[model samples]
Structures are given as C-alpha cells and as structure tokens.
Target: MTQDNLWQLDAHDIARQTTSGDLRAQDSVGAAIDRMNAVNPDLNAVVVDLSDEAMARAQALDASRDAGTPCGPLHGVPVTIKINVDQKGQATSNGVVALKELIAPDDAPIVRNLQNAGAVVIGRTNTPEFSFRADTDNPLFGRTHNPWGRHISPGGSSGGAGSAVMAGIGALAHGNDIGGSLRFPAAANGAVTVKPGLGRVPAWNPSQSAERGLLAQSMSVQGLITRSARDLHHAMPTMIAPDPRDPFHVPMPWQGRALDGPIKVAFTKNTFGYDLHPEVEAALDTARDALVDAGYKVEDIEPPNVFDCGRDGYRALMGEVYSLMKTDVDAHGSQAIQDIFAVYFQEFPPFLETDLLQIMAKRSHYARQWSLFLEDYPLILTPFLPRPFFKPDRDTEGGEGVHEVLGCAVYSYAMNFLGLPAASVPSRLAHLPQGIQPINIQVVARRWREDMAVDACIAIEDRVGRMCRPLWEHMASS
Candidate 1:
C-alpha cells in the first residue's frame, strides 16, 4: 500500500496487519502522528497530544509481538479521547480556561479500558465549556472546525473526536453522549458515533466529585466514535468490561445475535415540534430506500410523546447540575468563571428550587411512557439534526440562538433522558460542500440491548457506505 494509505486505514485493518507482523505498531503510530501533525492545526480537533507516550507504547507493543506474547483485540491501533474525560497527568479542561492548570491524577474508566485493550492514545480532543454547549470551543482550546468546510461546526462535545476521525488522525475515538454530544458531532462531521446504553462503559471522575448525583444515575453513557459500524462491534466487548469502581455498570457480554426475521424498522424524519431541514429529510428517504433494497420492512412511523422526555425531567436533572456548577465557579471567583455563570443564569432564570422538585417528580412518567412505546418498535430512524453542519462560531451565541440548538437537537436529547442507546451513521452528502447527511437512528431495545442498536448500524453500513473521506486529506498538503 502507498504511504498515504497507511494513515487512512481503519483501526481493525491496522490491528490485523500488526497482529500478522505485516505492519509494526511503531509504523502505524508514527503515521498517525504524522497525520495529526499535518491536519490537527487546521481542525484543532486534538489539543493535548501525548506523542512521546504514544510512540513508547507503540514500541512496547511491537516488542511484545516479536516476543510471541498474545495481542489484545485492538492491539497497536490509534485513538483519541474527548477532552472532557480524564487521562492521568492530562488536564480535563473540557475547553475551560479556569481549569487549564487542573490536571487529572488518574484516567477515567473508559480511557483505562482502551489502554488495556492495547490502543494507542494519540491525543485529547476539544469540547464545549464543561461540555455545556453543542459546539467544541472555549477560551482555552479555541474552535474545532469541520474538516469538510473550515467555517462549519463539527458538532459538540464530541466534535473534536468527530473532526479527528474524519481527518484520519485516529481509527477510533472515545466519546460520551449526554444531550447528543457524541452523535451530533458524528452526524455533522459525517463520521459515526454510538451512545451505548447507560453504564455499558463504566464512568467516574477522580478530578472532582460527581456533579448533581442524579446525573450519575441517568442521561449519559460512553462509547466509540469511528468511521465504520464494524469497528464499534469490534470494540464493544473491551469497552464494557466490568469495572468494580463503577457500581452502575452491568456485566453484559459484548456478544449478541441478530433477530431471526426481517428486521421491522421504524423511521421518523423529524421529531415532536421540531422542523428538519429539507436536505436532512431527503437523506432519511435515501436511507429508507437503502434498507428496503436490503429486504427489510421499512415503515414511516411517528414516535409518541417520548420525544418530550426530560422537558420537565431535564429541568430537574440539568437545573440541579447548573446550580452545582454555579457553586464551583463562584468558589473560584475568577472573572471568566463568573462570566460563564452570568450567561448560564440569564439563560435559565426561572429555574427555582420548587420548579426543579416538580421536574424531578415527572422523570418516571416520561421514562415509563418512553419505555412502553419502544416495546412495539425496535428502531426509530430520524434526522441527526434539523439541519446539517452549520457555520462555525454560530453556536457560541446564547439566548435566541439557543432555540436553534433545541430545534436542531430534537432527536438527540430524548434518548439521553430515557437512557436508551442511539447511533449516528453517515447517510449521504447534502447539496452543500462537505455537508454530509447523517442518519440519526435510535435503537430503543430493552435495557441492555446495546448490542441490537450496534447490530442495526452494521446493517445500515452494509446497505449504505459511511461518509466520504474528508477533503482535509487532500488539502493537508496546502
């Protein structure tokens, strides 16, 4: 293969070569770093890279292979971490300037597992301030632009991970989803991200005590961002290995069997009270046709009020989180942190304590209603956003602009509120340049059916290919 081809190959392909001694781990690691050095400056996807550590690990893995030691599932492959997650000795800035000096003393559970599986950590990607917004940028890390069009957003919290994967810096990236952070970026940037069912991958933070303890119980999970669905299936078992520190984690094996019938697929081009851009709806149509061509039963279906999940519920969940974060920022008393506080409180002034209590009371109602609805349908395909990738610097605006965020995010947040698994896969390109359409599908199986969600994604991949390679590869030489 050509030198350029080395960097663009997927993680599974790279691992297979390393396992068979056709490619040394160091060569793969070196090519990945070279790709990072070439494209990261423009994308700003990775902010805290561990080049030396990566090379050392790559060398060690190659030595072990030479010595006849067994290789791990993802042995010698490269990956990046979302900056919001902890990595020992690396700062979990989450794109906050106030926390730049705060370094983590230990790795988050997901990071530890990825390392244990023999993956090389190339660097850490950017996130919104505390992962609060849906675009990746802050005073600390600046903005992560889309590899397709430098002026467009890759999508947030996991935006950096999405950008890096599209730019060929790594084969896979570790991403967390709460309010569609992982899938939004994946869809916007024309990659793929899986929001595993809650507790599928253990989660914890040694950096600080948990914020709003209920957030620990609901609406968040970690999984992989990749260019292909098969990669997710390959990595799932290693990712969810039981970690005793995370009590919420269930010990489920990665293995799963596909149902023994033509899969009944349900699709919603838009969501409750949300308007999808015309191009996005067209992309869904294209995706539906692909499934029909694959001999599956495809039907247009409207999901019940499940999309209203966490309206009041999120008020209780996120309102409590906002208050806790306010307390921390106020403790620092820094002008920057204070400024963030002002924007937050101004955006959510009516969040009184009594209102929060009422919202919490409604959580079970929404969760139960959503659970009941999913029993009839196995999959719900929808638009990843009301629109495709929007212009960069657009999301930083709050207030009225926040409405735009909500409208675009209709399909994403509800899954978090219900703690169901969802995956975003690239469907086709929109009319705009580098503007690819991503099929935002929620696989709402019973609790612990993350396997079903991922399996559906693999089926989608078999029918329609993943996103086209980002233009950055060609532009990198410029």
Candidate 2:
C-alpha cells in the first residue's frame, strides 16, 4: 500500500498496523489532516478543524504505546465527530448559530468511548439546524457538499460525517441517526452505516440542558458512517461500552450467538405506493443476489405495515418536538429552519395530548409485529429510499419536495420507530445525467442484533465492491 494514501485506508487496516508497531499514530493523523485540508474546503464537511489537537493526541498515544500501555482496538485510527455531539471545550453547535458559543463542559459518552479506544478525532462535522433535516446545511456551518459531486445533497444530520469519510478525511465518521440521519447520508454518499438499535450505544450530551422527548430518546442513536462496512465493525464494539451517563443503555456483547443454519433474509421491493425508481429497484436486486451468493437464505417478503409505523411514529415525534423543543427552535432557529418545521408539522401533523400517548402506546404494537416477523427471518433486505437521492435543498421546496425526500423513506424511518438495527450499504452506482450517484439498500436485523445487520452489509459489500475507488477516480478527474 502507498504510504501517502494512508488517509484512504480503512479503520481495520489502520488499527491493525498501528497496533503491530508498523505504523505511527502521528503518521495516520497527519495523513488524515492532509486529506481534510485538501478536500474539506470544497466539501465543507468538517466545519471545525482540529488538526493540531489531533496531532498532539497522536503523539501522546505513540508515547503511551512506547511506554508499554496496551493498544486499544481503535489505536491510531482517524475519526470525525458530528457537531451535534459534545466534545469538551468545543461548541455543541448542532449547526445552530445561537449555540455557537455554547461550549460543552464535558465530552459526550461517544466521544469518551472513541478516545478511550484510541481513535483520534480529526474534526467536528456539520449538520442541519437542530440536526433535524434530511439534508445538511445550517446557518452556522453553511452546507456540506457531497464528495461525489456538487449536484447531490449530502444526507443530513450525519451528512458531514458521511461526506468526510467518503472523501478520505477520516476512516470513520461519528454520526447519530434519529429517523434516517445515518442511513440518508450513507445512501447519498455510497457510504455504509448501521443505525444501532435503541440503547445500543450510550448517548448523552453534556451541554444539553434538558432530556430529549420520549420518542426522540427511543428513536435516535449514535453510530458511525464509514467508506466501508468493515470500519463500522471495527469501531462499533468500542462505541457500545457501558456508560453511567446513559442509564437506559443496554450492556451486551457485540457478537450474538450464531444461528444453527444459514441466516434467513426476508427481502422486499414494496415501496409503499411510491414509485420505486429503477436504480433503487436494481440496487435492491443486487443486494438480494449478493446475499444469496454469500449463503444467506433470501426470500421475497414485504415488511409489515411500515407505512403506519412510520407515519404515526413521526407524528408522535413531532408532537414531542412541538411540546418540548419548539420553543427553542422558534426562538433560536433561522427563518429557513422554522419554515421547514412548519411544513413538517403540516405534513406529519403532530399528535397532541391524549393522542400523543395513544400513538406512543401504538409504537409497541408495531414493534411487536416486526419482532415476531424478525423471528422467522433474522434479517430483512429492503430499499432505503423509493428513488435515487434528491439534489440539495430538495426538502426546502415545501410539501412535495419533503414528500419526495422523506415521505418515500418509510423503510429508513420505520426501523427507528421499531428500534431495530438497520444497515445501509450501496449496491449500485449509476451514471445519471446529472452526475454519478450511488443507490443503497437497507438491511434490518433483529432487535439488539446490530452485528447481524453489519455482517449482512459486509457480505453485500464483498460482492458489489466498495464505493471509494470509483468515487476517488471521479474526484481526481472532476
């Protein structure tokens, strides 16, 4: 492997070499910093650069290793944290201008976990205001352009994380998903990510003044977006470490007990009445074929009533946001975000009072249905979106655009409502008239079986191949 291209290496390789003393932490951090400087000005993926701090940490890690401290699993690996998460002394801006000065007094659990595992934080990535959109652009951070091309929207909330990882700024990018934040960027950028199930990873921001809404707490999760699935596998175990801050977090082993036979994958192409774009359908086919080839028992099966689960779930979340967070949003949010939320309320129609509690209770019914179905098939292969990713600002066009970008994403959000681990991995690369884009498929595993979802993503990736090589070629030529 070329030494200069160390920034392009995956977390698994970087950690393996660094742990064996064949690579220095400083070298990995330096290469990542170089990559960030070269590409980030164009993409704006990393809004807060921490190159100097990263190098210092790398040097310290190297000295510790020299002094005979045991190497952690992620030793010397470069990673990026989303700005929404707390990093002590750094503002947990969440892409809001008003919060730009609200520096966190302590690191979030995810940050501490990554540092404890020896992963170097290269920089903080961007997000939409309040980290609440399907696309990334904020008054504070401007926008995150897709590394693939200017025409595409880097999927939001986690868009910066997705873009940074794919652009070789880092091997791993920390991101959170509360209804497709992780999956959206992974799909749009041809990156891979697993939205860990409820409580799979500890999540608590030290800068947060109040606890999140009930649905928000249940639906949202901390995870990573990576160029390849192996990087997720290499880093996620460390992310799941027990933290007293998150009392609800479930302490469990990364790998579950093996099944007795070939893993059954229930596959579906049902787009829930939305027109399934040919590219997306083709991507689902590719995933199905890949899994079958990889020895998974693939069967055609439609996901059970995801439309209802998604619709009611989002409405309930909107209610909570309206009840608890709306004041802050209205007070501090930009006009654009405020308008977007207004439209969101119109489309999703927030449930209120007793209705909110009723919907919250109904969430369990939907989860139970999926749980029973998952028992028959350990995994469900489905479409992440009904169509190819839309252009930037697609959601800003009002109801139609939001419908196009989000309404068709039932598969993506229903998993969140059900609190099941769902992995998104690119299966097809299309040379569209606008630009080259990647289409991703969804793999949902049983509750608390994020490893299973990631395992399936790896199998699909091994067959279809990683997206980074082609993406790099495009970047060099463009």
Candidate 3:
C-alpha cells in the first residue's frame, strides 16, 4: 500500500498488513497523523493531537514485534478517543469549558481496552457542551464541521469521532452514546456504528466525582464508529473485553450462536405523524431490498410502540437530567446550551419526583414489548431520521428545530432507551441541490446481539456500497 493513502485503509486491512510485516506500524501511525494535519484544520474534529506520544508508542510496538511478541488483533491501527472518556494523562472534558482543566488520573475502560488490543490513540475528539445537543459545537472546542460540507451538522455528542474516522484521521473512533450520540454522528457523516446493548462494553470515568443516575447508567453505552461495516467485525471484539471497573459488563463473547437459515426482519416506515422525507423512505426501501437480496426474510411489520417508548424514555431521561445535572448545566454551561435544554424541556416535559420514579419503572414494560417483538423477528429495519441530516445549528432554531431534529428521530433513540443493540449504515447517497449527502438506515437487533446488527449492516453495505469512496473523492476534488 502507498504510504500517502495508508490513512484510507480500514482497521482490518491495516492490522493484517502490520502484523504480517508487510507494513511498518510507525509508517501507519505517521500517515494517520499526516492526514490529521492535512484535513483536521478545517474540520476541527480532533481537538487534542497526540502525534508525539502516538509515534513513540507505534515505534515501541514495532520494536516489540521485532522481538517476537505476539500481536493483538488490532495490531498497529490508529484510533481516536472521545474527550469525554478518561485517558490517563488526558483531560476528560466532555466538551465543557469548566472541566477543561480537570485532568484524568487513569484510563477509562474503553481506552484501556483499545490500547491493550494494540490500537494506538492518535488524538482526542470534540463534543457539544455537556454532551447533550444533537449538533456538535462547544465553548471549549468550538464546532466540528461535517466532512461532507459545512451545510450539514456534525451530529452530536460523538460528532467529532464520526468526523475524524470518516475523514481518515483514524481507522476507528471511540465514542459513547446515552441517547443517539453514536448513531447520530454515523448518520451525519455516513459512517458505520453499532450502539452496543447495555453492559456490552464496560465504561467508567476515574476522574468523576459521583455516580450517575440509574437511567443514565442503563441507557449510556460505549461504542466505536468506523468507515466500513467490516471494520466493526475487526475492532468491536476487543472493545467488548471485560474490565474490572464495570462489574456489570457482560462476559459473553462478541459472536453469538448463528441463527437457523434466513433471519426474519421486521420493517417499518412509521414516522409517528412526522412527514417521512422521500429520500429517507427511499433509503429504507433500499435497505429492505438489500436484506431480501442477502437471503433475509423481510416483512413490513411495526415492532411495538416506538413513539410511546421514545417519548416516555426521553422524557424520563430529561427528568433524570433535571434532577442530576440541571444545576451543573445551569451553572457551567453556555447560554446556547442552556437555551437548547430549555427547548428540550418544552419539547419533552420532564416528570419530576414520584412521577419520575414511576416512569423509570415503566421502562421494563417498553423493553418487554420490544423483547417479545424481537423474538419473532430477530432484526428490525427502520428509518434513522424522518429526513436527511439537518443543517448546522438547526437545533438552535427553537421548538420546531428540536422537534424536527430530535422529535422526528423516534427510531434512533428508542433503541438506546430499550438498551438494545442498534447499527446505523448508509443505504443511499441523496444528491440534493446543495450537495450530495448520505442517507442512513437503522438496524435494531435483539439484546446482546450487536454482532447480528453489524452482520445486517454488512449485508446492506454489500448492496449499497461503502460511503468512504465517494466521500474521499469529494474531499480530494474540493
């Protein structure tokens, strides 16, 4: 492989080459750093560059290989760590200005797992303030622009991870999702990601002062965003490795038992009264057709009450935020974020006190319904958003903006609430008058079946083709 284009190689390919002595780990890391230097200026995707340390680490890995040490699956692949998570000497800022000076004393589980598996951390990515908004911008890191163009938002909290990985700064980008953070950025940047089910990937920040709410712990999950679906197969296994810090982490292997013959998939286009954009509907049809072609039995059947579940779940989450983080947000957050949260409360009124507890308890009822529905159909194909991704700061337009961006996105966050694995992949690249952008579809798998969801994403990707080629072509031309 040419050194100049080494940054474009996926984690699987990079590992194979580096492990077989066909490529040098130092060269691979250097190429990625060069790519970050070349493109990251305009994008602002990577806020903290770790090139010096990454190069030193890559050299050490090469020396270890020369000394006959057994290589990990990730070998010498470069990956980015989201700033929200601790990484030993780095700051766990989570895009908040007040926390910018708060340094971490140890590595978060996700960081340790990735580095342990031989993936070098090249840099730290940005996020929205408090990591709450759908768009990526903060008082600390400013805004991360979409690689497609500035016309689109770099979908939030994991926005920088999505942008950096897709822009060739890293082969894999570590990102966590509480709501739609992982899939939102994947949809925005045309990347592939599987939001791991509850306890699939262990998570904890050593620098934090207190424990999070029960709902926060249950809904939040650590995951990765990659440029190709096949990359997930190579990287996610190591990511799910158990950590002692998170006692709740499941010890199950990444690959589960293969289902008998063709898997049945439940398909739905129900937008919950929101107007389903033609492009989004086309994207769903493309995914359905792709699954059918891949020998999966696709049927048009709605899986439980997604609208009710999504609404109640987010409202419940808002209540948790209100009780737990509201004061901090009010005190430390910028006016823009404060305004966004104000709109969030208006859109999904929080249930307080006893009502909050009752709604939290009702989570099982929704999960149970989806669990039964998945028993009949192991996979569900649905629209990630009712339309193509919105423009930057569209969320700042007020109530209608929040409704358009989040309210219409019932399918994306519903999986997060249910604590089920969901994968997002591009099924169509819509050529709008403004510019070409990818349209993504969501695939929800049964609990602890993230492997299944990724498999379905690969099947769809096989038909629709990967998004990186056109994206790179655009980047080169521009």
Candidate 4:
C-alpha cells in the first residue's frame, strides 16, 4: 500500500495487514510519522513527537512477526495520546505551561494498557489549560485548529486528538473526558469519541496522587478518539483490563453481546433550555430519520435533566476538582495558575458557604434522578452541541458572552458527571465552514454498558456510514 493509504487506514485494517504479513509494522509506523511531519506544521495537532521510539517498537513488532510470536490484537497500529495522560518520559502538560516540564516517571495505566495490547504511541496531542474550556487553546501549545478550517477550533480538551485523526495522522488517539472534552471535539472535527463509564478504562496520573472529593472522583473518565467506531470497539475491551492503579477500575464484563433487539433511541434536538442552531437541528433530524429508516424505534423526547445537572451540579463539582490541581501547580510553577484562577474567579464568584453545600447536596439528588431516567431509556440521541461548529476565538468574548460555548457543555458534561458511558457519533456533513459538516449525538447507557454504546455506534455507522474525512491533499496545506 502507498504511504498515504497507510495513513488513512483505520486501526483494525492496519492490524489485520500487519498480522497477515501484508504490511510490515516498521513501514506503517514510518509512514505514519512521515504523515505527521507532513501535516502537523499546518495543523499543530500533535504537540510532542515520539517518532524514534515508535519506529523502534514497530521494528520489534516486525521481528516478532518473523519469529512467529503471537501478537496482541492491535499489533503495530500507530496512535497518539492526549498530553493530559501520563506516558512516562513525556510531561502531561494538560495545556499548562507552568507544568510543561513536570515529567511523568511512569506510563499512565491506560497508556501501558494500550501498549500491552500492541498499539504504538507515536506522539502526544494538545489540550486546553487544565481543560477548563470547550475550545483547545493555551499558552503552552497555542491552539489546535480544526483540519476543516484553520480559523476554527478543533474542540477541547481532546481537540488535538480530534484534529490529528481528522488530518489522517493516526487511526486512534487516547483522550480523557471530564466535561465535553472528548465528545465535543470529536463532533467539532468530524470524528468519533467514546467516554466510557468511569473505570471502564482505568485512568490515573502516577506523577500525582489521588483526587480528594466526590466531584473529583465522579467527573472524570478516560477513553479514545478515532476515525471509525470499530476502533473504539477494539480499544474498549483491551483498555478495560484489570489495573490496580485506579481504585475505581471495574472488572465488570464488557457487554460483548448481541444488540438487544431493535435499538430504542430518544432524540432531543435542543438542550432543555437551549436552542439548536438550524444546521445542527437539521443534522440531528437527518440522524433520527436515518435511525428510523434503519428499523430502530426513534422517539423524540425531553432528554432528562442533563442540562440542569451540568449547569447546577457538574460545574460546581468540576471547580472543586480543578482546584485540587492548585497544589500541583504551586509546587511546580504558580504564575500560570494564578493567571488562570484570576480569570476564573472573575467569571464565577466563589460560592458562598451555603451555596457550596447546596451544590453538593444537589449532586447526590441529581445523580439519582439521572439513574432512574436511564432505566427506561436505554439510549439517548441528542446533539453534542447546539451549534454546528464554533469559530476560533482569542478568548471567550463577542456579544454571545461566556454562555455561548459554555452553555453547550451540558450536552456532554452531564454524562461525565454521572459516570455513564457516552459517545459522540458524527451523523453527516452539513453547511458548516469547517468543511466537515458534522452532527454529534451522545449515546448513553448505564455504567459499564459500553458494549451497548458501541453497538449503537455500529448501528449508526451501518446506517449513516462514518464521516468522510478530508482527502490528504485538501488537508496537506491546511
């Protein structure tokens, strides 16, 4: 296969070729690195390049193949890690310049898990500072622009992973979601992302100690971003292997079972209190129609309280968890921490003692409500965001106010807070400046129900087909 073709093949296809001896692992890794060099300068998706190490690992895989040694499922596939995850020698910057030099001494559990499953970590992708906002931009690595349009954002905090996948730099990239980080960017840039239920894929930072509060433990989950839904199907099982590092890591059986009859989908065009832009609404309508035509029962309903959970409880919990990083920031470097906090304090006032208690109380109540809601509705079909795509902004300004992009977080952040498995699936191309016209719907199920989520994605893929990526030629100069 041509080098360009190697870059475009999904992880499963690459693995099949390598396992069958049709393609050598080293050749595939070299081609992937070359493609990264060819396109990264224009897109800036990958912030750290591990070309040498990746090539070495690829060569080892080839030698093993020749020696007739059995290989793991994802053998020799090139992938990227979002910089927020620990990958040994590299720092998990999380877009904070002050912590850029804070090197990780060991591979994050998920990184090691991927490596054990035979995936190569070719590089680290960019993220927003502390992943606080929806758009991926920070002083450390600047911004991850959409491959569809340089003038727009790729979505954060996994924006880099999303952009890199769209540019055909990697078949898969590791990403974690605390808010909409994984899903929105996947939606923004025409890719697919799964925020597996908490502990479905163990997440830990060996460089730092454990989190301290309810929100701290509740709001975060780790998973992958990829061009094809099948990549996630392959990754979810491998990544969820038992890891003692994350206490929350569950050994629940992956639902590798058959889909339970025709799937039931609940579609909500607008968030509870928000308006969906015409393009986004139309894209969602198209997806609903497609699902209906595919013989799945699609019902339009008020997506249960996801918006209120995010606005009222999720944000409060996230603020508390993020504040825990203050010590890490202070010990390593404090200037950036102070600057970001200054902005944060200005925007959202410190909660009164009573207000803080109220937020915490509401969290427990909200979690129960969401649990009951998911019992009847096995799947949800909702827009990832009200807007089709957002343009690049130097800061959250313009007459739209902080709430414009901030408000859209409800569609994604709520699932993270609830510890439910959710996915961002692009429905189709629409009239968006990003060229990759995309609509993302969050597919949710009970905790540890990732198998159901994947099945829904496969169902959607069988119906709509995966998003058509930009040709390498079109994105080469992007």
Q: Write the per-residue lDDT of candidate 1 for residues 55-93, one digit (tens) a residue.
A: 999999999999999998889899999887889999887
Candidate 2 structure quality by residue, lDDT tens digits, 1-478:
7778888889999999999999999999999999999999999999999999999999999999999999999999999999999999999988989999999999999999999999999899999999999999998879899999989999997999999999999899999999999999999999999999998999999888888888999999999999989888789999999999999999999999899899999988888788888988899999999999989999987768988898988888899999998899999999999988988998899999999999899998999999999999989998888888999999999999888888788887888889999999999998899988999999999998999999999999999999999999999999
The 0-to-1 C-alpha lDDT of every candidate, in the order given, reads: 0.74, 0.92, 0.93, 0.76
Clash-forming residue pairs, model 2 = none
Please report, as a residue range, the 10-residue window in candidate 1 with the lowest summed lDDT. 435-444
Candidate 1: misplaced stretches above 4 Å? 210-212, 329-354, 433-445, 470-478
lDDT of 3 by residue, 1-478 (tens): 6878999999999999999999989989999999999999999999999999999999999999999999989989999999999999888898999999889999999999999999999999999998897789998889999999998898988999999999999899999898899999999999999999999999999999999898899999999999999999889999999899998999899999999989999999998888898999999999999999999999999899999999888999999999899999999999999999999999999989999989889989999999999999999998999989999999999999999889888887788889999999999999998788999999999998999999999999999999989999999999
Runs in model 2 with CA error above 4 Å? Answer: none
The Cα error of candidate 1 at residue 452, in Å, is 2.2
Off by over 4 Å in 4: 209-213, 256-260, 318-358, 398-401, 433-436, 471-473, 476-478
Q: After superposition, how far is residue 338 of candidate 1 from its true place, in Å?
A: 6.9
Q: What TM-score does candidate 4 reach?
A: 0.91
TM-scores for candidates 1 onward, in order:
0.92, 0.99, 0.99, 0.91
**Cα RMSD of predicted structure 2:** 0.8
Better of 1 and 2 by lDDT: 2
lDDT of 2 at 180: 94
Output the TM-score of candidate 1.
0.92
